[model samples]
Target: MVLEKVVEILRNYKDEQDLEVTMASTFEELELDSLDTVELVMEIEEAFDTSIEMDGELQTIGDVVTLIEKAIA
Candidate 1:
């Protein structure tokens, strides 16, 4: 569920060159700035009905999936 929502959110920013975003993809690889990250977190929080505190440890899409899984668990 979390992965689907995250992919949906990511799709909103997809361009011709960025059609593929995988779990191993990092925010940097996506060219997401700090502001974009903040917005992404907000969207994720709203979708999952949970608050996610941003930490330095979250680097890849897999990290976000793990975080949401842990939160929802």
Candidate 2:
């Protein structure tokens, strides 16, 4: 369900055909540049009303989803 929500957010910012978030998805494959990545993180935080930790391990959309799920849990 979180992945679906993340997909919706990505769809709003980028072409759906160009990106897809599965459990194994990656940021580079999703075509998110540094700025877009930061924007996404902020948006996710705001949308979920939770703080995602700023860490080096969050290097992909899948990583983000995991982080979000962990934070919310």
Candidate 3:
């Protein structure tokens, strides 16, 4: 459920349909820079109604999902 929502947000944010986004997908692979990452994080926070702090430890979509799950937990 969380992964689907996250992927939906990512696809919408990037305006990409054909690109396959999975847990293994990295932000760099999605062509997201630091500023873009911050904006995406904001979107995720708003969607999840929670807060997330980053110290550049995240690398893959799985990392993000884990972070979100931890934050919400």
Candidate 4:
């Protein structure tokens, strides 16, 4: 799934990287600033061929995974 691929990308990061986002954490909790969020959305769009609205509700990695599943389904 695209969400799994996204998680894979994040998991491949270095220990010093700010990519340890998880389901229980908010984007802010992950230290993902505005730019990081934008980049992440873009990557997801390109990977899945779907556009995600920035409705301020996708606050965690799990939320994104659920959204992607809905889109794919």
Candidate 5:
């Protein structure tokens, strides 16, 4: 469920030049800036009805998935 929503959110920002986003894909690879990351977190929080404190620790898509799982758990 988390992966699906993450992918859906990512698809909105994906460009033709961007690589296909997988669990290993990082924010740098996706060309997401700090502002983009902030917006993404906000969307995730809204979707899950939870708050995620960004401590500059999240890196990969997998990291976000794990965080969401942990948050919702």
Candidate 6:
């Protein structure tokens, strides 16, 4: 459920980039830089109504999903 929403947000963030986004897709592969990642995180937090701590590394969409699950758990 959360992954779907995250993917939706990510796809919007994907902008004009012609890349496929999946749970296994890394931010790097999506061509998202640090600033883009931050913006993405903010959007996710707002969508989920929760704040995510940058206490660990987040590489892929799955990683972000896990973090959000923990936050909203």
Please name the candidate that would achieve the greatest lDDT relative to the true structure: 3
> After superposition, which runs of candidate 2 have C-alpha atoms over 4 Å from their true positions?
15-18
**lDDT per residue as tens, model 5, 1-73:** 8997788877765544344778898899888988998898888788888987689998888988898899999
- 1 or 6, which is superior by lDDT? 6
lDDT of 3 by residue, 1-73 (tens): 7888899999899898666999999999989998998899889889999988788987888888888999888
Per-residue lDDT tens digits for candidate 6, residues 1-73, read: 9998888888778764444678898888888888899899999999999998764498888889989999999
- Best prediction by TM-score: 3
Give the candidate order by descending lDDT: 3, 6, 5, 1, 2, 4
**lDDT for every model?**
0.81, 0.80, 0.88, 0.70, 0.83, 0.86
Candidate 3 C-alpha error for residue 9, in Å: 0.4
Per-residue lDDT of 1-73 in model 1, one digit per residue for the tens?
A: 7787788887785533445778898989988887888788788888899887697777888888888888889
List ranges where model 3 is wrong by over 4 Å: none
Q: Lowest summed-lDDT stretch of 10 residues in model 4?
A: 9-18
Residue-level lDDT tens digits of model 2 in 18-57: 5556867777787777788888888888888998876657
How well does candidate 2 score on lDDT at residue 28?
74
> What are the runs in model 6 whose C-alpha is more than 4 Å off?
16-19
Better of 4 and 6 by TM-score: 6
Report the Cα lDDT for residue 52, model 5. 74
RMSD of each: 2.1, 1.8, 1.0, 3.0, 2.3, 1.9
Off by over 4 Å in 5: 14-19
Candidate 4 residue 61 Cα shift, in angstroms, is 0.6
TM-score of 4: 0.71
Clashes of each: 0, 0, 0, 0, 0, 0
